[model samples]
Target: MSVATESVPVFAIAPAEDGQIAFPPAMEARFRPGLAAVHDEMLAREEVIALLCFGSAPRGEAKPKSDLDVLALTNGTEYWKRSRMINGVEVQLQVGPLQHWREDIEKGNPAMIDAFATGELLFDRTGEATALKRDAEERFRAGPAEPGPKFFQRQRYAITNIVLDLEDMAEDSLEARVLAGFMVLEALRFWCAAQRFWPNRKPWVMLRQLQGRDSSLGAKIESFYTSYSSVHAIAFTDAVLEGVGGRLYELSTDPEPVPS
Candidate 1:
C-alpha cells in the first residue's frame, strides 16, 4: 500500500523549532538514512500499520556497536524479522500483529511493554500505536503483578541448588566461575522480581537498575564480577536469599490426596 509521507504521523523524531531533527545529532547522522529506508520498506506493505523505534538507540544509551531495534506493527497474523547492516549499524526489524503486541502489554511482557511505553513512534497509520503506547505506560506505572509465593519458592529452590554446586567445585575452576556467573544473574532476576521491577536483559542495564533500587546490593554484585572473589559472590547470594526468605533446604509441596 502506498502511503504519503505527509499522511503518516511522526511522534518522536519531529523537526525542532530551528528546523533541526529532534534525535541526538550523532545518532541522527548514523541511523537516520537507514531508518528512513526501513520505514519506507515497511510502510510500503499493505499489512504494516505502525513502526516503533525502541531499545538502546531511542533510550539514548546506545553504544557504537549497539543495534538499532525497530518494531513494525502489522495487520497480518504472521510474524517476520529481519536484520540488515545499514551505515555500519545493524538494524533489527520485527513485524507482528497489533493485537499480539497489545496482548503482550496486557500480560506484562516486560520487553513489549517497555517498547511501547518508551519507544519512539516513527510511523503511525491509524493512531492505534498512540493508544497502545498510552496503555503500556499506564500498565508500567501500575507495576507488575506481585509475584506469587510459588515464584519465590521456585527461585529459592533453584538458587539453593546453585549454591550447593558452587560449594562442591574448586573456587578457581573455570566451571565454578561459569556457575558463579549464572548464580549472579539468577539472583538479580529473583531480586528484581521480588521488587516488582522488570529485570533488564542487558547486564549493565540490569545492574544500573538494581543500583537504583539498592546500592549496597548492587555493589556486592559488582564486587563479585570485578574481583571474582568467592567471598563476594557468597555475600551477593546471601543478600539475595535474605531478601527472598533465605535459603531453601526443603521445598514445600502440595498435600497428597487421601484415597477412598
Candidate 2:
C-alpha cells in the first residue's frame, strides 16, 4: 500500500508530556506582535467586538502545522480580515458573527472555550471574551445533559461512521477507531450532559461508568481501544448497538421502544 496518511494537524490537541507542551518563548513573542497589530487595526471597527485564538497553538503543544484559530466576533455582516507570517507559517484571520460565535461558546465547545480560558489573550474589548469564558465555565459546572434529539442524531451518525471505520481498520489501514471512541464518548457525555451529569473529558471516566452499568460491554470497548484492533472494535460496536436497541431512538427521537 503506497497510500500516505496525512500528518495529524498540529491544531488538533492531544495529550502530551505535561511540562513539555507549550509554545516557545520566541514563538509567543513573534505571534503576539502581529496579533497586537491586528488588534490595533480592528479595534476601530464598529461591528467587530471580540477576538480570540483557538486550537493547540494556544495550549502550548503546537507543532509546525498548527492553524492560528483567530475568532473575529462581529456584530453583523461586516468584513474583517487580516494576514501575516508568524513563526515561519502564513497566518490568516477569520471574522464571524458574535451571536453565532457565542452560541457555540455556550454549547461548551471544547476547542474555543479551552483555548480562551487557557490561551493567552492578545486583545480584549466589549468584555464579551471574558463573559464567554465565564459562561462556558458555568455550563461545565452545570454539567453534561441527557442525550436529546440533537445528541442522538449526532451519535447515530457517529456510530454509522465508526462502523465504516472498523471495516477499514480490518484491512490494517485506518486508526479511525481512536477517533470513533472519542465520538462515542462525546455522544455519551452529551446524553449525560442533557441529564445534568458532568463526566470528566477522560476516557477512564466513561469507561468506569460503562463498567458499573455493563461490565462485559465495557470490557469489549476497553479491549478494542487497548489492542487498537478493528475486529475487536467492530464486535464491541455491535454489542453497543444491540444494547441500545429501542432506547437508541430515545437518545435522539421520541418513541421509546415497546418491549418485545
- The lDDT leader among the candidates is 1
The residue-by-residue lDDT of candidate 1 on 1-260, one tens digit each, is 11124433455333222322344333546777667678777766779877888887877778888888989998889988899999898999999999888888877798898888878877666777777887888877877789988888989998988988898989888888888888888888788888888657777777778899898998899899998866677789989999878999888868879998
Candidate 1, residue 222: Cα displacement in angstroms equals 2.1
lDDT of 2 at 201: 68
- Give the range where candidate 1 is weakest over 10 consecutive residues by summed lDDT: 12-21
Question: lDDT of each structure?
Answer: 0.79, 0.55
Candidate 1 clashing pairs? none
Off by over 4 Å in 2: 1-37, 43-49, 74-84, 96-100, 103-120, 149-228, 235-260
Instruction: At residue 30, give the lDDT of candidate 1.
Output: 76
Tens-digit lDDT string for candidate 2 (6-26):
431222111122212223243
The lDDT of model 1 is: 0.79
The top-ranked prediction according to TM-score is: 1
